[model samples]
Target: MSSVRLLIGTRKGAFILTSDGTRKHWDVSGPQFAGWELYHLKGSPADPNRLYASQTSSWFGQVIQRSDDGGKTWNPPGTKPEDLMGPDGMPKGESNMFLYDTSAETGKPLTTHQHYDGTQRPWEFKRVWHLEPSMTDPDTVYAGVEDAALFRSTDGGKTWRELAGLRSAKGHLWQPGAGGMCLHTVMLDPGNSQRIFVAISAAGVFRTDDGGRTWRPVNRGLKSQYELPDPDADVGHCVHRIAMHPSRPNVLFMQKHWDVMRSDDGGESWHEVSGNLPTDFGFPIAVHAHQPETVYVVPIKSDSEHFPPDGKLRVYRSKTGGHEWEALTKGLPQRDCYVNVLRDAMAVDSLDPCGLYFGTTGGQVYASADGGDSWAPIVRDLPAVLSVEVQTLP
Candidate 1:
C-alpha cells in the first residue's frame, strides 16, 4: 500500500506530513513559502504528482504555486490565467482586490477596488479563493475569487476566461459578516463534469448543473443566523464548509453557521443534524470516503468568545447519520485548550477505516488512524493552519 501524505496550509507557510501507515511517527517538511500566508493547498486529481498552493503576502500580493517534486520545491505558474489582460496590455477591468477589515471600526468598506497598472511588477497577481481542476480535462482549471467572480482556464494556468454569471444582479447588496462572502469552497461532481456546487459566506450556497452556464440558489432548509425573527429561515443561511460523499452522489453534508445540516437528495433540501453535536458554531465538516454514513466535525463554543467547549479540544463523530455523537479525542490536549479549527482545516483519508486529519488555530495538526476514535498530534509549532488535505499515492 502507498504511504499517506498530508498537505497543510497555514497563515505562516505550508507543510507536508508523511506516514508509513502504521505507527504514530510522522515525517514533517516545511513552512514552504516561509512567512507567507498560505490560504488553500490542494493536489490535482488530474495529476496526483502535481501540487497547488494559494498564498498571499503583505508586500507581494496573491499567488498560486505548483510543485512537481512533492513539497520539496515549488514554483509559481509562469502566467496566472486569472490575471488576464485586455488588448492594451492592461489587466481586464474585472481584476479587483479585496481588503478585509476585522477591526471594530465601522462605516468602512470591507473591501476596496484595485486596478492593475502597467507600472506594477509581473509577479503581482490576483488572489485565488478556490482552485479546481476539471475532472473531464486535465488542462482545464477553475478559480473563484474574493470579489465573488468565477474564472475558467483552458490552457492550465497560462490563460483564463471570466464567467460573469456568478455576479449578483443587485451588486454590492451582500455584506461581509465575520468571514465575508468569498467563494471559498467549490464542489465538483466526479460523475458529471457539468454539475458543480459552490459555497459562499453571506449568500449561502449555489448550484450550476449546466457547467456554469446557469446558476440557482440551493440554500433551501438552511438557516441565516444574521437575520432576526426566525434565525433558521431557509434560503439565506451562512454556510462554512460543504462535503460530498465519495460513493453516494446524492448524499452531502454541510457545516452551517448555527446548525449542522445533511441533505440526502443532493442539496435540494436539508435537515438539522445538530441534535447530537455539541454545538453548531464550528467551521469544518468531513465525511468518510468509504463510509457514507460516517461524518466528523469539530465543535466549538458558538458565542462571541469562540473557544473550544469546556476549554477542551475534541473531535466529534456521528456514525449513524447524526443521530448521536461521540468524542474522538483520546491522546489530545485535555486542559485549558483554546484552539479553534476553521472551515477548511479538517479532512478525511481515502483509505479504508479512513484516517482523519484536522489543524487548529494553535498551529497543530491532529491525526486519527482508526476513524475518529482516537487522535494524536502529528505536527506542532507551526503557523496557524487554514486548510488540510490528504492524498494516497499510487
Candidate 2:
C-alpha cells in the first residue's frame, strides 16, 4: 500500500497532510513559514522527495522555498531567481515603468508585494498563477505571474530569467489587465518540450511550436467579452484555467469565464464542453491522469457573486468529455456554505483508482479516493487555500 502526502498552499502559509492510501486517517502540520501567501506547491516528478513552494509576502515580496526532508524544515534561497528592478533601473521607452513607479511611490514598498514578502494585505502580489517543472529537465522550473510574464529557472530554483517572447511581442507589448498581463497557467507538452501552451488572463490562449521563440494566439472558437466580437478574435478572452491529459497529448480542456471548451486538435480549435456544467462561470478544471475523458470542475456564481452555486457547494464531474455532468457532494458541507474555489485550488492524483482533491476559501481541504463518489475533509482551519498538490513518496 502506498501512502499519500498532500501539500496545501494557503493565504497565510502551508499545510502538509499525510494519509494512508485509503485517506481514512490524516496527520496535518504547519502554518509553515507563516505570514506568507503560499500560492503554488509541487514535488519534483523525477524526485518525489524534493518539494517547491511559491510564497509571497507584503514586506518580503515573492520567494520560492524548498524542502528535501519532507516538510520538516524549509530553506529559502539567498537570492530569488527573478529580479525586480528599482525605479532608477527603469529603461527608456518602457510604458509600464510609469505604472511600476506609481505603484512603488504609493503602494508601500515593492518588497511588500507577493513575490517579495510573505505577508498578506488586501492589495499585494495579485497572484502566482502557475508553477511548472520542466518536462525535459527536472532541474528546470517555470512560474507564471499576474504581471503577464514568465520566469524560468535552469538550476532548479536557484537562478532565473524572464522569457522575452511574452514581454516583447512583435509590433506591440502585451497590455496588462486589472492584475496586469498575468500569465496564470503555463502548459508544457511532455512529448515535445519545445511546444508550449500558455494562458493569459484577458489575452486568450497562446501556443509556441518553436520553443517560445514565437507565439500565436490560438483562441479560435472561444468567446470574447465584448458584445460584438470577432469570430476569430484571439485576444480579450479571460481564461481561468487549462488542463492537459497526461496520456493523450492532443486532448485539452479549459475553464473560461464564459464557457468550458475542449480541443481534440491540441488547442488549434475548440468547441463548447459547457453543456452539462453548471453555469459557464468558474475557475479551475482538473483532469484524471489515466482517463482523458474524465474531468472535474467546481462552478461558482460569476465574478460578481463568485460564491458557490446558489450558495450551495458542489463538485461537478464530466466523464464523457463534458457531454454530461454529475454533482459529487457526499461528505461536503450544506447550508450557509459560501466558500469559493479558485482557479488553482482543485487537483487530481495519478493513482490507480485516482484521487480527487480540492481546497476552499473557507480554509479547508477535501479529498476523495474513489474518484468523486464520496469525499472527506483532510485538513481544516487554515488560511484561504490557493492551491493543492499530492505526491507519492518512495
lDDT digits (tens) for residues 1-394 of candidate 2: 8888888898898888888777779889888978888988877776676677888876766777777677787765333323334358642221111121223232223222222222322222244556787765666777777666566767666655555455333213234444455788888887887888888776678887887756777778887555215644656577788998877768889998768889999888989988876687788898987788998888887777778877678888999988698888898886678888988888887677889889999988988988888888887678899888888654
Lowest summed lDDT window (length 10), candidate 1: 114-123
Output the worst ten-in-a-row residue range by lDDT, candidate 2: 93-102
Which candidate gets the maximum TM-score versus the true structure?
Answer: 1
Q: What TM-score would each prediction reach against the true structure?
A: 0.85, 0.84
lDDT of every predicted structure (CA atoms): 0.72, 0.73
* Winning candidate number (lDDT): 2
What is the C-alpha local distance difference test score of candidate 2? 0.73
